[model samples]
Target: MKKIALLLFPFILFTFSTFAQSANEDWISLFDGESFDGWEAAENPETFSIEDGKIAVHGPRAHLFYMGAAENHDFDDFVFKADVMTTPGSNSGIFFHTQYQEEGWPAHGYEAQVNNSFDADPRRTASLYNVDDNTEVIFPDDEWFTMTIQVEGQHITIMVNDEVITDYTEPEDVDRGTNVLSSGTFALQGHDPDSKVYFKNIKVKPL
Candidate 1:
């Protein structure tokens, strides 16, 4: 019996290692930390900058789109997450299912509103914009939190620090083009000059 168990142990270890490797392959890192190597910024490139390994969003209105080398910078069913920190009165957002625009607010996709204490927008963090707004503030200002957005087909889920905040399913009669709920890339919003937000460890796992 002991000899048989020893023989099976090696096979079990190999199988477990192989499964772990496959799971890791399903995930991809979107940000390289030092610079915006695979990202594209709108109008003012200065609005998006890397500070101490975090993607700092400040300055005037602008959007940073992910134009990465894989999948043509587009994703359909995937789980995206980032570590975010907001200063007092800061406002920002994480936009998905959106296309790239030269200037102005992203006409395409849905924005997961990121605001803690900003006076302009009453909607706090984890609200799925107008689609499914959650007025309950789940994040704290001047602290780091994990913001996660997961999309599977017509369903969307937004979470803050592992807490589910918004779960929305797209309606059949939704609008088409640039504000539409369709397959597109991801983006980060720079609300205004007064707002300052930090994001790091941006990653995605295709479902």
Candidate 2:
């Protein structure tokens, strides 16, 4: 019995160590907090700025794409999360399964709408844009809220402050030509000049 116990002890230790290492490796930060090191800004560069450990978006129309050095800044199945805060009447969004665009709105990927008291769009915070949109004003303006998104295969889930909000599944026959869902990098939106939003702790865990 003593010999059997000794052999099992080593095997258990090895298994635990391997699991912990993989979990840590799976998570990667898209933002470094001090600068836009692994990201690319399109259109107005002044729109995106780093202030007080947060990515502040407040100037004009622009989109910041994650161009990090991981898998060529491409992720297929992963969990994306960020701490976001919006001002009153502000509007913004986070895009997933998207690519870099030199000008105009990104033609690819899906937008997870970030809105609080904005009167223009009915879609509120933690919404999956047009697809399975969420209209509840879950978060208050000027306060930070944690938004979490999980995408695996055709399934997509969104949460606000750890509360499940949207659970959507893309149809198998969904068109792939236009706003259809596909694998790509992530992006942060600067909706307009008046809209002020802050984002931080942006990270992802590939599945």
Candidate 3:
């Protein structure tokens, strides 16, 4: 009996160690280079199209989603990275902890904004969209930029082209008018008609 217990103890420890290692792996690709298999659109009625090995938002619609049925997955803390390109006045965002609904902007999740210049709105690019403030202009429209967002607990960090732009932690007990750093599905926002946004090399690492 003593020998059997010893063997089981090591087996349990090894199993847990392997699980921890898998959770910390760097950069799991969200976009499969061929399809939007694991992603979903958000509030906009706009359609997300795949062309030339890239996922793009095209055509006219409010908001659309490509999520798994019945909220099967959600992320609480993770590092998300994607390469995005947009037209001059194009506006889009990476929405986290997103709740899917019909016809309206997501009231639950947070948006890691995407914009170019100050063309559409001064708060256009890289802004936290009403939750926090955006001060720097780090996006160059029509040019590819690498955007990275790290969410750990209640703290969030936004980086563009490896440059730290927006770093904020949500205030505890403060009402941001929505859910705060809970957990839900991840989404890509397609804002308005005629707004074209392209996403590639999308990856995430859970913390």
TM for every model, in the order presented, reads 0.94, 0.89, 0.79
Give lDDT per model, in order: 0.90, 0.91, 0.74
Give per-residue CA lDDT, model 2, range 10-108, as digits (tens): 999999999999887788888888999999999998899999999999978999999889778888899998999999999999999999998788889
lDDT of 1 by residue, 33-146 (tens): 998998999988899989999999999999999999767888899999999999999999999989899998888889999998996777889998877887877778889999
Better of 1 and 2 by TM-score: 1
Residue 78 shift from truth in candidate 2, angstroms: 0.4
Residue 52 lDDT in candidate 3: 93
Give me the runs in candidate 1 sitting further than 4 Å from their true place: none
For model 3, residues 1-207, the per-residue Cα lDDT tens digits are 999999899899999999988765655767777966765554443468788988888655545443643335577788888899998678788888777777677778788888775365667566777667585666577888898888898898888888887889888886766657888766777776778889888777767
Q: Estimate the overall C-alpha local distance difference test score of candidate 2.
A: 0.91
| Pairwise TM-score winner, candidates 2 and 3 | 2
Candidate order by TM-score, decreasing, is 1, 2, 3
